[model samples]
Target chain A: MNPTPDGFSTRHRGGKKSAARKVRRSSAVNRPSTVKRGKVVSVADGNAAIISKSFQLRSMQRAWNRFHAGSLSHWTTTIIIALSLTIFGAFTLLLSNANTALDNWTGDNLVTVFLEERTSIEQIESIQTEISKKSGVDQISVVSPAQAMARMKNMLGSEAGLLDSLDDNPLPFSIEFRLTDKKYKKTANLVYEIGTWQGVEAVSYDQIWAEKLAAVIHTFRFVGIALTVLLLTAVALIISNTIKLTIIARRDEVEVMRFMGATDSFIKTPFVYEGVLQGLFGAIGALLLTSLLYWGGQGAAAELGAAFGIFFELHYLQVGQLLIIMALGIFLGLIGALISLSRFLEI
Target chain B: MSSESLPLLIAKGLKKAFSVGKNSSLEVLKGIDLSIDKGEMVALLGDSGSGKSTLIQILGTLDRPSSGVVTLNGINLFALNPKEQAVVRNQKIGFIYQFHRLLPEFSARENVMMPLLIGRCSPKLAKERAGEILEKVGLAGRLDHRPGQLSGGEQQRVAIARSIVTEPVLLLADEPTGNLDSRTAGSVFELLQKLNQDLGLSCLMVTHNNELAQNLDRQLHMIDGCLAEEERGK
Candidate 1:
């Protein structure tokens, strides 16, 4: 149940062969992994308990050796695979950042309510009271028409003369409030609640623009996933072909293996390990390339953002992302090798 | 498991046929029945295309008989699943070809250690045992030499060392010294005979050499897919 132990049970009785045999029989796994499952006979009762643990280590050791068996073509194919995967990793980071940007836009969390013209002080006070009493409203501030005009004049500075041409103060008395985190749960309901107030003329927030950004981000994500699947299939085919070469080069070895009574799993395991090795290395290279691209992309992205209102900064892969990348590389290689070897091992 | 009193190898009505084309088959072996006792060394002699090689392949379980049963030590070999049959082959049988088919990249000792490694023996023990067998074949000094580096006779010697390393119940060799010179072939055959006697290993070898066939415990000649128990004068 622990998954970490080498899958051995330590309970023991007398020197009964059946008792020792019981420990080996418990594994539901019918097939052996890298380590050949050990035969627990011949050893004493105490020593037999640790046999699975020993074989577990041996399988890993053998796998490591087999992974490094072939070179020239293996290296070339792996490098190409790594480059393709790097492009995949980079796009994954971009898509992640797009979602992050949309979240941040929503997280600004401010609501503004515009008041009717000629609204009295008592009416403004009542509106403020109602806004504060709302479930998600954290703090409220009411800006009078006169105060708003004065603030605009100070902001305009030299352009204050342009506002003097107006016959009367045009700015509306508005109420501004900071919403709590709970505001996002039912943003539309809260907006509707404030708009129904007697003195309120209109209620406005950044929700429309944020929703638009979210839609765009979702579309990009869908496209990115489709592209990634296609690229991964290509990687698998390349690896399968490369492993085919390795298998062909070692036909003599395989022939000898068959003649000597080696099981299909026994012969195919080393090749799978070899594929995994290539995949592991390919993933490491991909990870490094992604890191470098992110580092280099920071300036280019900033400059491109300046031309359009749109802006995003490339985010480097997170720890979880890195783990995923590694897992993907290994899985691809494993699958690629398996796919390749299966054609040759039709028996 | 059946009773252990049965012969080590039993091939009854063994027939092998290859499909030459659509609806046309070339029958290589026709209803051949044979048995070899425990610890017996037997040689099969025949001219080219006499079906000697095909008979051994079927007996070795490398090729399935078109219609027949090969029982090894009372267990029906062909009846068992391929995986189970392979396990029996690994632990119970050894094979040597005319050409020493050692992995070119591996050294002599490593070549011998391969089957033990495949059987999941620890590397240390497999290596130690491989070294011991190489010594037995008088190649103790050639431990590190690759098959390509070893001479014709030495490579054959390494092949012999590998075949006996697992202490198999049966060894199937096909023209083990066909490519070697007469003197080298004689020496290799002598090494094989010595190992078979010293280790109590049973053998079923296929060769065209009458001189070599005369030295075995018995000779069976294959004439056009039919086996004749040939008599010999010492």
Candidate 2:
């Protein structure tokens, strides 16, 4: 039955189709792998002819083959996802810490009490003593009008005469009270208490600064949450689509695996592993960048502090937060890969 | 032997169709009724687009029949769910195509062990079985080579090793040697003949080669999606 053809061709048999063909049998060997059933122990010759009706054997083998074959892209994707998530974690931790420091350090809670013009030194001293005992007051500093002017002159040397030439001491005698916590409600309560004191002409706290602080805190929390969610959704999508593209590129390989009797789970394992690997790698990239930024910021802060007595600290990525970020990145990659694979496995 | 007495694979009035172009349905196969008995090598010969591939797909349970029933051994194919159908396909049937569909990323031995692994056989046993089969196919030394590294004929042999490693009841081939050179193609056919003789494996092949088709135990020619002639051959 072997044909000795030199090249590819289709020879037409003189009509629409050939008719009355004869059948011949040849004892040929070396058949295609698809047809060759290897020699094995059998109870009867007919038992070999009767194809055993079991599908699990081949599918299991295909799964193992895929894993060992390095056909799995899931591992790679997982690493990338893990890395991206770590960045998010670092950002969230640093942001929260920064907010806490700002709320604690702001001057919004400082209260100043102006003394009455007719008030004597003895009366002012008693008022200062009473204000210091207030529950919210952290500390109180008393500045007399004359002392205030002297201090202003000592600092402005050249402008000292201009300040002294004033017809009267323009600076008022005042007692400044600081609050423990910068909560606006607490600050207002303290202000109300101080304003009711005798010999006090006026009581005011930095209301504008208080309002600004409130706005900053609110906006920060809101923007942080929104950005994190948006970035995560984007990351998830990118990983999912990337895995899907990989699947499409390797569809033929998948088909081959299926024909080998691979189950859906078997076919999906390698892809999931690859996704996780990708996520982890991405997370590591983000961490490296975050680490560099932290180091650079700390260096800059040190230079600034040396040049001028101003201190600044950029929040760094905490270990716990870093771990969570890594985990999240890996999770995102796996989920994304699974989503893409779900659609293809149905076939 | 009477048709009912010979046990292998039987499809009664099997029909398959596919929808194309959104609304139009093209019936690829008009009802086909045939039986492949034990130890018989049946050849399905037809030109391209004559539903030859479609018939093999349905019979192998890779695709569903639009109508009628297919029974492999004693189990009804259409009655089983997809998971169970997959189980049936894995356990009972083997397949060979013109193109060696051995996974390129996996070694030849690993490819052969796939079916056994899927069936939950122990790794040790699967490995031993795979080793034995690969040796039989004369690929003992090339077991570690992936499909990409092997010649076309050798790759096809690996594919063959994978298909029958689990000892299925029926093997389906769709022009198994159509992609090989004449010499290699002949050798591949010879291996199929050997497996049939040595193991009594029942085989049904779809081919355009009349010479290869005629060598089977029985020849069924398809014209316009129906069996035109059935001849008993040497």
Candidate 3:
């Protein structure tokens, strides 16, 4: 029998326990056991449930300390996302501005003249020469009825060839004219005056088509604005979801932070900062990609345009628009982080 | 023994059960009664499935008991909401697990300062306290080393420093030495003993090794969710 303080049975597998074992068992007497107090019957019944301000400060510090180590992966994801957005942005710009340029191309004043059926070839040539001499006429080209018919047959295929076999030569001789419209809408008046000529049969113009095209362009501009809004929303959602997944992976860390006395705000602060950082990097990456594509496209268009002594160029996003893009990227990133935390920071 | 006037932790009739498999329930702790005084240390001994960890978790307020009352510094933990419970745990208690559980990405000093910062201390104060604790735990030279860079013993030391930096009322350890070699284990235990004595901090440690259990101030052997025997320090 052995007598120790608060003794029970001294017998065991051996005569004596080791000094380390004695030291290990001695700690049991150091504190009052919750078991003896009869208060902690389960996990829920403890008194240590308050968080102090110091805990929150600690959490913020830990988050900042870990910031650099975790930043690389976050930055990489943001850059990839930004690159994709830039490509889509460039595509949208090309689609919208290309149509704008084409509208301007068609709006330049041009007219077509129809000659009487019996009008001789000399009359058409003289009419072209007379039109070219006019101050309003920039250039004119006379087409003989037979040559016009042959060109139509070549362009329109078998149906047009069949028209050439008709009993009467129904095709009209014509001259096409480019105009310098002082009042912009004066091309219509010029057409009316040309129609009243003795040898002229009729005048034709595409003013109605131009008006309709203008309406279509107006609708396209509205659609482009809507698409941009939708794309930005999508970008924000994607970034937010990604950040949410990251939060899930670090759940244990978050739990530890909470136990360390960190407030919810303290924990979330670094995450928001991280999201903005990622967004900024992503925006820069996207801008770089957009510029590369723009320069390459301009070079290719210029090369193609050189063949016909015509010049082609791409219009880029203006400085103001570029600023908006960066702002939008950062805003979307922040929104994404907010969305992620909404689901994760419940506790 | 815990003084009735300044009891550090009090647990009453704690019961925790879990539903596992289909229509089957297993109770981990059944009507456990415990108390810890300020500056006391107790070793909770148990077999493989004796619910020691569950008990420690509940006492630490990391988890809620299915049915029971726990009061730490006279505050009823079970009555509080999850948010409040988190606040309490953050401020009043510190926990160490079998594994060091140190964040691999952080340096030793940062790891130690986690609880202090989370408890909302000033960065300078947290840093200073973290430095003090690290030095106390024999980690003075490894403050800037990450967990991966430090040896296992050093990492555990860092964990010890982290647990004590907040000056928590209760420090819970779940097999703190389970992963270490015998020599390193002794040194770790020695550090814990020094902290308990020098700081007068309360501790509740769960361990399986009968050898480890016998060295604490008091030992309670838990079997089948009930405390079977208790022995006090000489």
TM-score of each: 0.76, 0.75, 0.65
Q: Give lDDT tens digits, candidate 1, residues A99-192.
A: 7766666776678899999788899999899778877777689988899899899979999999999998988999988777534447778889
Per-prediction count of colliding residue pairs? 1, 89, 81
Model 2: runs farther than 4 Å from truth? A1-90, A106-108, A116-119, A122-141, A145-171, A180-182, A186-211, A300-315, A318-320, B1-6
* CA shift of B190, model 2, Å: 2.0
Model 3 misplacement above 4 A: A1-76, A102-252, A299-313, A318-324, A331-347, B1-6, B13-27, B78-87, B141-151, B224-234
Interface RMSD (Cα, Å) for model 2: 16.3
Between candidates 1 and 3, the one scoring higher on DockQ is: 1
lDDT of 3 at B208: 72
lDDT of 2 by residue, B1-234 (tens): 543475678788877778889999888778888988888899999888888898988887777889988876656777766555655666678889988877665678777866665544434455567888898888999988888999999988998888888777789999999999989888989998999888789999988888887788999988778887899987
When just chain B is superposed on the true chain B, each candidate scores a TM-score of 0.96, 0.95, 0.94
TM-score of chain A of 2: 0.64
lDDT order, best first, reads 1, 3, 2
lDDT of model 3 at position A152: 77
Please provide the root mean square deviation of candidate 2 (C-alpha atoms, Å).
11.8
